[model samples]
Target: MTRAEEQRDAGLLDAFAGHLALQRGLSEHTVRAYCGDVLTLLALLPHGPDGNAPADLGALTLATLRRWLAQESGRGLARATLARRVAAVRCFTAWAQRTGRIATDPGGRLLSPGPDATVPQVLTAEEAAAVMDTAREQAAAAGTPAARARATRDWAVLELLYATGVRVAELVGADVGDVNLAERLLRVLGKGDKERMVPFGRPASDAVEQWLAARHHLLPQQTSDPGALFLGARGGRLGARQVRDLVHRSTALAGVRDLAPHGLRHSVATHLLDGGSDLRSVQEVLGHASLSTTQRYTHVSTERLRSAFTQAHPRA
Candidate 1:
């Protein structure tokens, strides 16, 4: 492939990615993953017309895709990674066929091993309480106005995370009007552009109230759109990276295992199931599109129960 052909291939990939983002409603993170998988396959194939880049999607074949997967496996990629690659290729092939770019989908019969069922990390109630307490203490001991604002915001961030089990994107995407203090409810726009209302407890509500009262400290002095629920030091909408950094810092201060926002989400779902919340209810709260996706937490609950029995029974 010549440089021009490579550019065309790259442009096609970008077009497919845009389709996934706008037409398919996939989140940016997911779209990026799909693009990465496709790019890996493109890089593996022989060069195109100019012997510099891979051929176009219309030239793809089942043998070509299988070879790519086999090569990845030979290189020691995980089952999950291989499976995701297969899915990405299949999605792209189907799109190509639909768009008249191909006569048939080469990845129609492609398959890979299923991912291993690994349990996600979950924080116990006591551990979660300690995290919150640490954030609260930080807020109380703030030496400056900015420090106090951050401390308060951190507290609210943790509380809302644990209370609602919302993803980091949803938490940061929230607007000031999305929260209802009196009703203890939050309107969240989750993945796939789906909207759901999740409830929080009194502690989360109180923390948010404190942050709301003093949140202006974190906002820019001459802000135009003042409806963001959370703000950075520069008063812009809080990005996902900042929220992740804050979670890491808070967990470190509490001297507990470091947890990402999704880990906090897992903790809440596991705790809810442990406390007798039905699987469907947990699914609804987590905004999962399928019950099977939510069923993994049951395994966590079962493992915890078996562990308790092993420690207490002592019959062995």
Candidate 2:
């Protein structure tokens, strides 16, 4: 493509990203993923008006979309990755059509392989308890006030994560005012800017309260209120990566498998299902858009029951 064409493409891509973020209300992580996929597609395709490939949405075609997927498949991309690319293209095409930038959506017929049916890793109730208890013990053993405050923060992070199953992004994005300690509930802004109130048990409430008491210790020297529920050692808002590391460190200390924040979410959903919480309620708690997405946890719950039954059964 000419320099002018490349610049135009970049501008259009930026506009699309802005739409995804401000208008569609996608999370930052998701918006980044979608934009990355689209950028990759643009790079792979031929550029310029005379080229067979499209340089803009108006010139895009179903064949071009299929060729893009074919090239990705030839490059040995995973099925899930290909599926996501197809979705990204479709979303962009739909938006372009809606906004009158394109006469028709070229990705209307685009298709990719379905996702694998692999189960997500989750922690057992015992494992979850052990991790929390270990963090609590560490907090109790801390020597300095700063160390104790961080330990207390870690305890609350794990407790709230397990108790409410909020995403790491949601947890880190939370502000102090969002928590309702009196009611044992906290407001979380979930995907697509949808807000939901999640309730936590007394244990989580107590942990949060303890952290709040010492929260001032972690405050930056100048800033009176950082406004973030969690904070880093330097007193700025705690990032998602830091929260993930905290979860990993806590689990390792407890001698469990290395699990991410999402693992806690999976664990909570599975445990809820195992304890007879209905699928719909789990769906609501997790903010899943579809029941089918929530139903995957049933496999984990069912396997646990099957194992229990097999162990106790008289005749095999």
Candidate 3:
């Protein structure tokens, strides 16, 4: 592509990113992924008459869209990746057509493989309790003020993760004001910037209160984001990566199968369903956009039930 063509594509991507962020309310990570997919699709388009520049949006036909997906499949991309790419192109084409850049939305007719059906890994309720207990034990054993603060924060993190089933992003993104300790509720901004109130248990609330008491130990002289509900060693807002590391470390200490923060989310959802929480209620707490997404926990519950039956049934 010529320099001018490359700049044009860059400008298009910039505009599309704004649309995804401001209009669609997608998260920054998702905006980047969608933009990257669209960029790849644009690069794969047939050359224009100049034979150097890539074809314009006008060339985004259904055939070209399908060809892009076929090429990605050939590259051995996962089904979920392909599906996201399809969504990206469709979003792009619809925007292009609306803005008069393209006469038609070719991506409208395109299709891709569905998301993978593999079940997520989760800890049993007993295992979850063990993880929380381990975190509390670590806090109690800490000898120094800084160590105690960090350990207390980790305990709070694990308790909140299991109690609310909030995504790691949501937990890390929360502020001090977002928590209602007295009411045992947390306000989180979920994917798509959707806000929801999730109720946690007393254990989580008490852990958070303990961490709050010790929070100043980690506060740096020049702290960043002092209002953050959770703080790192440097006194900045807690990050998703830090939360993930804590989850892994705590699980290992608990002598359980190590899982990421997301696995903890899965474990909470499964436990809730197992304990007789309705699907709609779980959906609301988890901030799932679709009820169908919440239904996956039901499958996990069923699998557990089946395993127990096979192990204990006399008929077998």
Off by over 4 Å in 3: 1-8, 46-55
How does model 1 score by TM-score? 0.91
Clashes of 3: 0
Off by over 4 Å in 1: 1-8, 52-54, 74-78, 311-316
What local lDDT does model 3 show for residue 180? 97
Cα lDDT of model 1 by residue, 1-316, tens digit: 2455446468778989998999999888889999878877776555666765545565588988888888878989878788888888899889989988889888888887787687568789999999999898888899888889888998998899999999998998899999999999999999899999999999999999999988978866677765789887578888899989988888888999998888999999999999999999999999999998898789989988999899999693
TM-score per prediction, in order, is 0.91, 0.91, 0.90
Q: Judged by TM-score relative to the true structure, which candidate is superior, 1 or 3?
A: 1
Assess each prediction's global lDDT (C-alpha) against the native. Answer: 0.87, 0.87, 0.88
The sequence of per-residue lDDT tens digits that candidate 3 reaches over residues 97-189 is 998888988888887689877667899888999999999999999999999999999999999999999999899889999999989999999
Q: State, as a TM-score between 0 and 1, how close model 3 is to the true structure.
A: 0.90
Model 2 misplaced stretches (Cα beyond 4 Å)? 1-8, 49-54, 74-78
lDDT of 2 at 89: 87
Error of 2 at 42 (Å): 0.6
